[model samples]
Target: MEKRQLTYKDAGVDIEAGETLVERIKPFAKRTFDSNVLAGIGGFGAGYLMPKGYREPVLVSGTDGVGTKLKVAQMANVHDTVGIDLVAMCVNDILTVGAKPLFFLDYFATGKLSVDVAADVVKGIAKGCEIAGCALIGGETAEMPDFYPEGEYDLAGFVVGVVEREDYVTGESISPGDVVLGLASSGIHSNGYSLVRKLFFEVLGLKVDDYVEELHSKVYEALLEPTRIYVKSVLKLLEEVPVKGMAHITGGGIPGNLVRVLPEGVDAVIEKGSWPFLPIFKFIQEKGNVPEEEMFKTFNMGIGYVVIVSPQHADRARQLLSEMGEKVFRIGEIVEGRGRVVLK
Candidate 1:
């Protein structure tokens, strides 16, 4: 009888592959570094120096994962964009409170580590941080044998931001007559993918590469459009406009998310048709035969983010956002009522 020696790689984990991925992604992460990033990738823990300015600085933090959207990316063999969706999901949430994103971190886990795919994903993450004006400080990559199937991985992100204590937009200031502005979404920005997949694949029998005239792109292209990052634009608008409240529309769509920001005495009255519904949404609604209310609840529809300001500041806010290259719409207004959202 003889015994055979086994190594980590034999167990489906490649230590060398992990190290190689670290090397490949270093340059990508470094590109997002700012002076405040005390230490970046390859460290046991990343370090960041808080910018010195606010009298009472408040640290805001958010964490999120790119829910089943990763499946779409994997099916399409598109690894890069979902990383942006991961960062956008977290950063946008913290931005709702007027926090300026300071840094980001990510978690990637899979059965077998493919250095090339992982690198592409990290590259996209760095790109997201650059767009967000934040440093990609550090992250973790785990190769768990048999945990995830081959060629499949999951992503999660964490972001830290800072805002002055008095400057935090708590939605408490959202009152009657405040205008609700809708910021155009970049088509199916990271939500409702479960239904999307069903409609396009199982029901419609569409392939990832199948092109549809209505969407003007392949199925995956429309479904995997990276979630829009509103940090820079919203942060800039906050400086010039008194944004009473802000909501990063995610899983629950506009009504579910926007209602969270309404004060006890006000309701958000969203006027339908005020904003252009992107073709993807229209296609999903018509193809899925999803009811109007269900569409608003499950998907962002068109608005990725919502900002509330006094009527006096609405026009100015819209102009500034538009000048910043955003498709801004005066979609609704706040009214006196119990805290809720009403679509008209």
Candidate 2:
């Protein structure tokens, strides 16, 4: 047998394809640039100038991935919206600290580079930046040979924002008698898909296109709903109201994430039955036989973002948020106790 010469392409990595994908994505990324963005794609690094108005500004940065939800996207052949989830998972965390998103970057890695799929995902990233009022300054796309399964890729996002030094919403100010106002979620926002996939694929053997009456949609659509972005509504609330603390409900649910924003001697008590029912949760619970506590621990349930304000401002805060088109719920209150969360 004659030996064949090996090349990078033969090894399944195509530098030209990666370059071509970059060319295809430039215009999409350019659409998200703001005046603060000082450079374009293909640069060794991105450049962003601080916005001029703040007398004292603090930089806030966050990074997050889409988790196993990427598998659901692959199964549905829906690459676009997971990018939105990628951006949401990070920017929403920065929002908890009262920062305004200034720019975003992404990491995209795959076994093989599919221009169409990568472009679709970038489009969603650009759209999310627009929704968040940030610029998609840059990103990296890696085509690793035989690393990820065919037709599979992973996405992560990084967001940078700025908050006035005095305006940072550290939970230090949270005290007893503060009210917790929860903002409704869009549906299963970017957490707990390991169990979701087990229920849908392993246990129930449900297909991506399978429809359930509770969700009134295909399994993939319901599960892959983009994570909600609370930037606009939250920024508006901070402008007009005083927020003692805030939390972005993610992997650990209300009890988990909310506790991060409580004072040492205070606790949050979430009142059950205070908000509208989210049907997808009921479906997941019944289908997986998942306990209520585990479900709350793993998922966001109906509430995605929580704001703790003094009791005097609770109603006004809710009214202001509602006026801005947020589905507001008086979910709980802070009380004197060790820093913790209790649901009753």
Candidate 3:
């Protein structure tokens, strides 16, 4: 009797399929390129040149996964938007450090390879990279036949960026009188979804197809909207404002995220009433009865990014952000205290 031959294809993983997907994605990937992108898809390593004329450029890299949002994607059978969520997670963190995103990489794992499914995911990543002014440099697609259920997959992103040492933005320069400028968020942005899932699905008996105004879509569409990418518009305002520190309101919401940058003697004192809360947040508030404090610390509440700048420059900073097509609010102030964030 002849024995069966062993092959990667026999294990339900297909290199040929991956190659075909890469070929298909190349055109879409190229749209994100700048002159610095030295190579495209199908390379052992993706390359980008150091932007010319940086006095002392420091490379920044951040790796992140879209926590639990993947569950929403899997449940809804929507794979595209989660790829954007992957990129947003990394790029948003890099933006907090004043870095210009250069390139991004993704890691996708599934029990079985589906070209159509993965292609939808990559399309989202390419679009996200384009928005962040970054290239889709490289990524890993793993097919672990027995590791996950056939219909389930996971996605994560790694992003690299560059910022000059002298031009870096951090909390060292943040002072007591600096104003806290809040940039409004679109829904929850990517955190607290596990709780949301419990609320909408398990507890309330809501189906993915159920329509809710708070979600602004059939439950699935509402959940699948990509996390907003804020790098480009805010980077443009760097010229006119004296930014001392910045924070991306993510998993820990305002208090948790903002305090990451507070100096030893300065704290972020936020007043909740300065800006109008989006109805979605209010819906969650009423439906969940999530206390104001729990809501602020657990979710973005409304603000996606918090900017610290001088007291006198507050108006100009707020004005410049507003001029750039952003909703701005003087949400709080810096106070002389321990390095912590306080919400009023």
Q: Candidate 3: which pairs clash?
A: none
Compute each candidate's TM-score over C-alphas: 0.99, 0.97, 0.96
In terms of lDDT, which candidate is stronger, 1 or 3?
Answer: 1
What candidate 1 gets wrong by more than 4 Å, as runs, is none
Predicted structure 1: lDDT: 0.92
Model 1 clash pairs are none
Q: Mark the 10 consecutive residues where model 1 has the least summed lDDT.
A: 215-224
| Clash statistics: count for each candidate | 0, 0, 0
- For candidate 3, lDDT tens digit of each residue in 131-242? 8889997888888889998788888899999998877887798987889999988767789898888878987789888999665678887767778888887787776777
For all candidates in order, the CA lDDT equals 0.92, 0.92, 0.86
Over 45-118, each residue of candidate 1 has an lDDT whose tens digit, in order, gives: 99999898889999999999998989988999999898899899999999999999999999999999999999
Error of 3 at 184 (Å): 0.9
Residue-wise C-alpha lDDT for candidate 2, range 7-69, written one tens digit per residue: 999999989888988899999899899888899688889999999999999999999999999
- In candidate 2, how many clashes are counted? 0
| Candidate 2 wrong stretches, greater than 4 Å | 1-5
Which one wins on TM-score? Answer: 1
